[model samples]
Target: MKLTSTASRKLAALSLDEIKEAQQEASRQFEEFKARGLSLNMARGKPCVEQLDLALGVLEALHARSEFANSNGDDCRNYGVWNGLPEMRAIFGELLGIPDDLIILGNNSSLQMMFDCISQGYTHGYSGCEPWCRQGDVKFLCPAPGYDRHFAVTEYFGIQMIPVPMLKTGPDMDLIERLVQDETVKGCWCVPKYSNPTGVTFSDETVRRFARLKPAAKDFRIMWDNAYCVHDLTDEPDQLLNIYEECLKHGTEDQVLIFASTSKISFPGAGVAALAASKRNIDDLKLRTTVQTIGSDKLNQLRHVLFLHDADGVRSLMKGHRRILEPKFHIVLDALEQELGGLGIARWSHPHGGYFVNLDVMNGCARQVVALCKEAGVVLTDAGATFPYGADPNDSNIRIAPSFPPEEELREAMELLCIAVRLAATEKLLYERAE
Candidate 1:
């Protein structure tokens, strides 16, 4: 699909009469959308049925008669392998660019591991440091338009969240460096590669800056969530600097804790999650986690190991994922281009990989747009959800998750989304005129 050039005049430039006409047309389309009674949702970044079906081998990888022991002869049927299966760790280590000894596997959710890390800081402290719960008014640096679940965890713990601007390259490093100077600032959340909603991969320089951070707090950490490290949608994928290596260079390897998983690559609920940090951090984490449970499901770990044998196997699997995801994303882009292109009221990112397309409609129009879509039987992730504390000062950003729906549904959803955006912008403009 050919995109319309931006050379045309913006919506804000049109005369009162032209704006009225546009508003009337948009309102008509919105009503027609409502009449269709289409229950479409583009809210969460869930893999499509076909993508999940590709990993059905994982279910059959193990059985009652299968080998219950790992290569090290550690019986997976009973207790032991406290950290994780050695071969599984090695595979994840290779995939995440970390040493196997520094990596530790958890159950299914990397987010849970992240919460535990923060909980550890709050409860027991890190490497014998003072517990954050005992500390006065601890704060966390949150890069705006970030993952909502990250914010949710911090909020649940009652940690103050400070919003820092996020750019196409990465978070604003200058501000981050300045903010960490406060002793009360305990940590920062990061989604380095193919980040949550905007899909902004941190540039080499940004990562290097993160590594060299000189914080006032002894336990300042960078929660590096590399959830989409291998979820590339193109052959020549965007490269991300290795945070662990960069931290090693700066002699601050303990300052970063990397999190990753096979959630999108395979089944979401049954996938494996892992954390890679400094030996000291890993030791501290293990000491705290020892009280939680005996060990993670080694049987499930064995299944993942058998299904996706190595880094090469994971890469090949991701290529299959791209074939399904790339077109869905394209449908969204095409619809946006054909409908709202050349209209200065909106702008969106064209990510090479990641599950979402970040759309920034006209300021103050996002919530109205979302409401309009919902009223028309289409649901979107609420406006300002990407920001810390559910606030977007300008209320512009909207994360579009195109992966869950089928191709035709995605096309229709995008069409409705575009119409909602236009209608909201039109309404806002008319109201401004009246005022």
Candidate 2:
């Protein structure tokens, strides 16, 4: 039946016949399904196998003749360059849309740069300020439903996490501005473009407010991890408001620390990453990182430069990735629509880009749904993995990573996923009604 505007609760609930019919349609698939003996994962943000194929050439790039030498004519084969070589820094700066001077070339993983920054702040200090490890208490504002690794880093440091609500435009800016005013709040983590799980981009206003934050601690910084800067799956890309430029416009360029990685672009294990920020922040970051090494691999930098001359090369490559991922994405989306379009028990995002699709199930049923999927041999990201400390107060957010699986696998996975979702949601509803 069609739902009328301003309908009452009783009218909104589907009739018993509709529910039974829907269940039967779903049951036929489950009853007819056979054990495919497949052990698949749709849990992590890792790139798809076909997408990963794009970087296979990087192995040759690494072994190529002339690209292995740095600015000083040194061999990258040796152990050195902890902050990364210059050519690599240039590649990262170009990739992330920042000036090379402001970008610090990090090793293979961008997560390490973030982790190292936090570790340094806790110990040595940021830009001549008092070390956070020396402070009695330090707090971080975590944009809820964000990257798990970021939260994991902060949690490992015993830093207190204050959850900030996320919206379509970005994290609730009003709440962020107010909280930052407190002296104890020192930092916040943000994946500005195509944010993990939610795929929400930060609006111009949100970026502006973030740049202008008047934190009580002079050392407070915005951890801007733009991991999906070039990963647009749709033909029409979702343009993001550059937070670094917003900072410059707001006259607070010193407040943002941005990072990007080529891990997803090339090889996750051997890719180069970089950190972009104000010169002041760079100088400070160098103080800690400088002692860590001599220079990053100029060879990989040269390899990427030789391979992908400019941003266009990156875009051209992503087009290839989009081809592989877009169809798989639609497969999951269609299955969700087919199985749960108006059930009033679940909702999910159809993001134009990014590696994830966020599904919010009936309140308190997400963990149960994830458990059900696991029993059927499909591995999913932990139900609460999107939130800080792996705890979702509502237990409703479920991140669906579609990039890793093939279309056929995704279709089957999503079909099974719908059953799991419905079973868990129904049980929760009945149990709650009983209570």
Model 1 TM-score, 2 decimals: 0.98
Give the whole-model CA lDDT for all candidates, comma-separated.
0.90, 0.80
Best by TM-score: 1
Model 2 stretches with alpha carbons more than 4 Å out: 1-12, 15-38, 62-67, 70-83
Q: What digit string (tens of lDDT, one per residue) describes model 1 on residues 1-435?
A: 111333286888878787788888888888998999999888999999999999998999885556688999999989877899999899889988899999999999999999999999999887578999999799999998999999999999999999989998899999999999999999999999888888899999999999999999998989999999999988779999898998998899998999998999888988999999999998999897787989998988999889999989999999999999999989999999888989888999888898999999999989988988899888999998999999998999999999999999888888888888888887888899889
lDDT for residue 421 in candidate 2, whole number 0-100: 77
Assess every candidate by TM-score.
Answer: 0.98, 0.92
Clashing pairs in 1: none
Worst 10 residues of 1 by lDDT: 1-10
220-309: candidate 2 lDDT, tens digit per residue: 878999989888999788888777777887778887889888888887877778899898888888877778876666566667766666
Q: What is the alpha-carbon lDDT of model 2 when measured against the actual structure?
A: 0.80
| Predicted structure with the largest lDDT when compared to the true one | 1
Candidate 2 local lDDT, residue 435:
90
